[model samples]
Target: MTILIGCAHGTRDEQGQETIHRLVEDIRTALPGKEVREAYVDVHGPFVADVVAEVAAEESCSAVVVPLLLAGGYHVYHDIGEAVKDRADVVAAPALGPDPRLIDIVMDRIREAHIPDTATLILAAAGSSDPRSQADTEAAAEMLRARWSGPVRIGYAAGIHPTVDDAVADARANGEDFEVAVASFLLAPGFFQKRLTESGADHVTEPLAPHPRLVEIVLDRYRDAGGS
Candidate 1:
């Protein structure tokens, strides 16, 4: 059987850790006989390189690394890419965002916050210097805009201009009478989510993990990379 390695950018937050762990467990449950494991690209281990190396050494087993990240960035292109580059038995899948189903989860979060119809929505993401990552985030914002009636904007928690605070501030200045709501485009609760909450928006939506749809997305990505 092929192995599915769910690799996430590790977090220091305990709840964040639990959320990611639960996500991996759900993936395992979804694919009963397949071997599923967890690895990280940053902040903690088992790091992606080590995990891939170990899996590649095993007999009769190929591995697919599915990034739990919302978008492809430095970690995906450099870290995960480097880990699997030399190994014929290992391949890496795309990051999880820019998917319509994820937008569905974001919309649900916005509704749960009871955001007003007049509220301006800001899609908040953990930014990256990589142009590909920025493009992925923009695609996600466009997806959200298609379903949302209100105006949609993009903001970052770090790494690029127009921070969440700046986005919230601009929304308030341009549409003073309208409420500003931030829809977190993050995967789990952690530093980035906290930044969104503190970005001065009238409301902030929750992160988009610990959901069944996410598990489905992971499975699809694994299959797309030729994993069994």
Candidate 2:
């Protein structure tokens, strides 16, 4: 069996756990024949290494560790990659960010949130200490800014530059009654999402969950990875 592992940067919130579980179920439904497992990098149960070891031991199968993260960061390189190191049967796929489809998703969120050109939009990601992660978020923000026709700022919930509060403050200082619409650049609702909401932003968009388009993206990645 081909084991498709949905790896999340785990959260302490129970609601976050539920959201990831739901996504895993949707992923399984998308790839019916494949066995799916949800694992976390930290702050929750079933670390990626343990999950890989458990599944590889039981099934002697090829494992695909798909990060539910927004960009290539420490978790992608160190944690998830390390998890698959001892397991010859496992391969780690790219993080679920920076894909062209994600641009479309961001546009969708903007439209759904009814953000105006006057609105100072913040693409708030669960930031990383990794510079690459911040850069990726900026790249994604640039893509969105191209199509958005508005001031789109890249902000982080934690870790690095122009944090949510800073984004809001900067926009406010710019002298417009900016509508702070949050495009959650996260795969699931977690502490970051909660922080974004509590950050007193004017509006918040939903996380990129198991939307149909996202399911298609996951399946496409599996195919691209040479999965059957």
Candidate 3:
């Protein structure tokens, strides 16, 4: 069986870490008898390189490192890619984002938040310096806009503008007089998700975590990499 290594950008929040771990467990449940291991790229132990090294040493097992990130960033492209560089048996999978099922989950979370139809949505994400990452986020915004008739804007948590607060302020200043809502594009309840609350929006949706679609995406990524 091919070993699936679930890699994520770790968080300091206890629940955030637990969320990733639980997601990995869910993957294990979905793929019984396959070794599913959890790993972190930052802010935690059990790094990707170590996991890849250990799994590569195992007998008769190929490893696939699937990132739990939303887009291709430094961590996914550089950190993860470098981990399994020389390992013949290990493959790095693409980051999960800009997928239809994920968009469905985002819509579900927005509906659950009771965001009114007339509201302006700010799709807030943890920013990345990588151009590809920003492009992926822009693509996600376009996808959301296709389903939502109201105004939809993209905002960053750390690296880029307009920030969430700025997006909210822009919405308020608009002549349409729409109610402002923030769609948290984060994967879990971590520091970045918490920043959404301070965005001054009328409503903020919950982060996408432990969703069944996430498991599907993980599996898809692994499969796309030709991992058994």
Candidate 4:
């Protein structure tokens, strides 16, 4: 039997870990016969490599590593790829964020905010030091902007420039009378989301946790990973 491994960035926050754990459970139930497991890339326990090694040894099966992350950042390229190396059995799926369905989540957040046309929208990501990661974030932002009517700007909490504050400032400079609605492009409540909130955005939407559609997306990744 092939193992469906859901890999997350991991956080010290117990609540955050619990949320991801629950997501994995949802995926497991979606494929009752498959052996599903969870792992983290950092901070939390059961690292991806360890989980891969454990499942490969136990089931004598290859695995697919589906990132719970939002985009094809460093975790997808360097960390996850390196961890799965030498294990010909493992295949990594696309990041969770760029999935077309994500636009629905983002749109919902915006609509839920009751954001006014006068308000400028700021899509905030956790941000990565990796240029490729930022590029992916920008790509998502562009997709969102194309569909959104209001002024939208892409910003990060850490890594690259134009942080949440910077995005707000840019919007204000553009004479947007910026409300700076923060559309958190994260999967769960974590440090980055908290920091973005504290950064003084006028409005901040919660992360995309416990979303029913997300469960469907995860299952698709698992099946596409070659799970039977």
Best by lDDT: 1
Q: On residues 101-155, what C-alpha lDDT tens digit does candidate 2 reach at each position? A: 8888877876787767677788888889887777788789888888776688877
Tell me the tens digit of each residue's lDDT in model 4 across 1-228: 778889999998878888998888888888878888898888867898788778657646888888888887788887788877888788888777677688788778777877766667788888888777787788888888888777888888887788987887778777776477888888887788888788777888888876778887777777777766
Worst 10 residues of 3 by lDDT: 169-178
For all the candidates, what are their Cα RMSDs to the real structure?
0.8, 1.7, 1.0, 1.6
What ranking emerges by TM-score with the best candidate at the front? 1, 3, 4, 2
Tens-place lDDT per residue, model 3, 1-228, is 789999999999999988988899999998877889999999987999899988888898798999999988899989999998988889999899878778888999999999998888899999988999998899999999999989899999888888999888877777758688999999999899889988788899999997999999999998899776
Compared with the true structure, the alpha-carbon lDDT of candidate 4 equals 0.81
Per-prediction TM-score: 0.98, 0.92, 0.97, 0.93
Pairs with steric clashes in candidate 3:
none
Off by over 4 Å in 3: none
Greater-TM-score candidate between 1 and 4? 1
Minimum summed lDDT over a 10-residue window in model 1 is located at: 171-180
Give the Cα RMSD of candidate 2. Answer: 1.7
lDDT of 4 at 95: 77
